[model samples]
Target chain A: MARVVVDVMLKPEILDPQGQAVANALPRLGVTDVSSVRIGRRIEIDFTGEADLDRAREIADKLLANPVIEDYEVRLVEGAEVA
Target chain B: MARVVVDVMLKPEILDPQGQAVANALPRLGVTDVSSVRIGRRIEIDFTGEADLDRAREIADKLLANPVIEDYEVRLVEGAEVA
Candidate 1:
C-alpha cells in the first residue's frame, strides 16, 4: 500500500484561537520560550495501488481542506511506518 | 526563531470516525483506489530562540495528546518556510 499525507493549515492571515489558547496556557507549564503555536490537520490516505500525487491532491482540494481559510500540501510518504 | 512540529495521531487500533467519513465520501468524488484514511493533528510551535524537541514533546504529552489512544512525534523543522 502507498501512503499519502495531506497537511491542512489555516492561512497565515487567519487567527487561530485554538493555538493561541495552547500558547497562553504554556506559561503555567513553565514553558516560556515558545513564542507561538498553530494547530492544523494531518491526514493519511492509504492507496490500494500506486501512490498518486494528483489523485491525492484532488482529494485534498475537494474534501480535506477549506480553500477560503485554509491551505493544504499533499505529498507521498515513502516507507512511512503505519500508525 | 526556530519551529518544532508535533504530529499527533490516533493509535492504529483506535476508531477514526472522521477519517472513515471522509473515505466514504471519496467515492462520490471518483476516488476508489483509496483503502483507508486517518485524520490527525499537526501542531507547530515556534520558539523565540532554539527549536527544543524535548520541550515540544513535553507539551504534546501533557496537553496535546491523550496517552491512552494517541501517539505523537516531535521534530525540528530546519529552514522550513512559514505557512
Candidate 2:
C-alpha cells in the first residue's frame, strides 16, 4: 500500500478568515505572543497496491485542490501508515 | 521566529464524511484511485521573536485540537512560514 500526503494552503495574497478567527481566539485563551495563524488542509490517500505518487499528484492538482486560490504539495508518507 | 505545524485528524473509528465526499468525487473527475481518503487540518503558527515549541504544543493541545474525537501532532516547521 502507498500513502500519499497532500498539503494544501491558501495563497499568500488571499485572506484566510478561518485562520484569522483562530488567531483572534488565541489571546482569549491566554495564549499570547503568536503573531499569526494559517489553517490549511492535510489530505491522506491510501492505495491498496502500487501507490503511485504521480497519479496522486494528478489527483491533487486536478480535483483535490483549487490551483487558482490555493497551493498543494504531494508527497509519500513513510510506511504507508493509514488508519 | 518559530514556525509550528499542527496536524489534526479524526480518530480512525470516527466517520469522516468530508473525506468520503472527496473520495466519491474523485472518480467523477476522471481520477481513479484505489482505496480510501482521509481529510485533516494543518495549522501553521508564526511567532515573532524567540519561537518556543513547548508553548506552541500547549496551544495546540488546548485550543487548536480536540483530543476527545481528534488526534493531533505538533512539530516545528523549518522557518516561520505563515502567510
Candidate 3:
C-alpha cells in the first residue's frame, strides 16, 4: 500500500477569513505572542496497491483543490514499502 | 520576517468525518478512481525579525493545534533569508 499526502493552501492574493479567525482565537486559548495566522487544508489518502502518481496529481488539480483560489502539492509518504 | 509553517492532522484513533465528506465529493466533481481522503489543517504565521523558533513551536503545540486530538509540525520557509 502507498500513502499520498496533499497540502492545500489559499492563494496568497486571496483573503483568508478562516485563517484570520483562527489567528484571533489563538491568544484566547492561552497561546500568546503570536503575530499572524493563515489556515489551509491537508489531506492523506491510502492506495490499496501501487498506483499512478501522475493520475493522483491530476485528481488533485481537477477536483481535490481549486487551482484559481488554492494551491496544492502531493507527495508519496515514506516507509510504506510493500512485501 | 520569518514565516512559520504549521501542519495539523487528526490522531489516528479519531474518525475524520470532514475528510470522508471531501472524499465522497470527489467523484461527483469528476475525480474518479480515488479511494480515500483524510483532511486536516495547515497554518502559517509570519514573525517580524528574528524570533525564537522554540516559542513558535510552543504556540503551535498549545494553541495552533490540539495535542490530544491532533498532531502538528512546524518549519521555517525556505528562501526567506535576509541580507
Candidate 4:
C-alpha cells in the first residue's frame, strides 16, 4: 500500500481567522516568544496500487481542495517502497 | 522570521468521522481508486527570534493540540535562513 499526503492551506490572499486565533491564543498560554500562526489541513490518502503522484494531485486539485481559495500539494509519504 | 510547523493527527484509536466523510465523498467525485483517507491539522507558527523547535513542540502539546487524543510533531519550515 502507498500513502499520499496532501497539504492544503488557504491562499495568501485569503483570510484565516482560525490561524489568527491561534496566534492570539499563544501569548495567553504563556507561549510568548512566538510571533504568528497559520493553520491548514493535511489529508492522507491510501492507495492499494502504484504510487502514482499524479493521481493524488488530481484528487487533491479536483475534490479535496478548493482551488479558488486554498492551495494544495500532493506528495508520496516517505519510505513506501514500491517494487 | 522563521516558520515552524506542527503536524497533528488523531490517534489510531480515535474515531475520525471527518476523514471517513471525505473518503465517502471521494467516490461521488469520481476519485474511485483511493482506498482510505485520514485528515489532520497542520499549524505553522512564525517566530521572530530563533527557530526553537522545542518551544514549538511545547506550544503544540499545551496550547495547539490535544495530547489526549491527538499526536503532534514539530519541525522547522524548509529554507528559513537562521543565522
Using Cα atoms, each model's DockQ against the true complex is 0.94, 0.74, 0.52, 0.76
Q: B60-81 in candidate 2: lDDT tens per residue?
A: 8887788889998888787544
Candidates in order have lDDT scores of: 0.94, 0.85, 0.76, 0.83
Cα displacement (angstroms), candidate 4, residue B63, comes to 1.9
Runs in model 1 lying further than 4 Å from the true structure: none
Q: Which whole-number lDDT from 0 to 100 does residue A57 have in model 3?
A: 82
The true-versus-predicted C-alpha distance at residue B16 of model 2, in Å, is 0.6
**Candidate 4 per-residue lDDT over residues A1-83, each given as its tens digit:** 88899999898788899989878888777777777787899888888776679878877887779999999988888875432
Question: For residues A21-78, what per-residue lDDT tens digits would candidate 3 score against the true structure?
Answer: 8778767766555666778888787666665577678767876789989999888888
Indicate the worst ten consecutive residues by lDDT in candidate 1 chain B: B74-83
Per-candidate count of clashing residue pairs (backbone under 3 Å):
0, 0, 0, 0
Residue B28, model 1: Cα distance from true site in angstroms = 0.9
TM-score of chain B of 2: 0.86
Candidate 2 chain B lDDT trough over 10 residues, lowest sum: B74-83
Residue A14 lDDT in candidate 3: 89
How many Å off is the CA of A38 in candidate 2? 0.1
Q: In model 4, what lDDT does residue B81 have? A: 45
Least lDDT summed over 10 consecutive residues: which range in candidate 3 chain A? Answer: A26-35
Q: Distance (Å) between predicted and true CA of A14, model 2?
A: 0.6
Across B1-83, the per-residue lDDT of candidate 1 in tens digits comes to 89999999999999999999999999999889999999999999999988889999999998899989999999999997754
* Cα lDDT of model 2 by residue, A1-83, tens digit: 78888999998789999999989988877878888888999998988787788888888887678999999988888875554
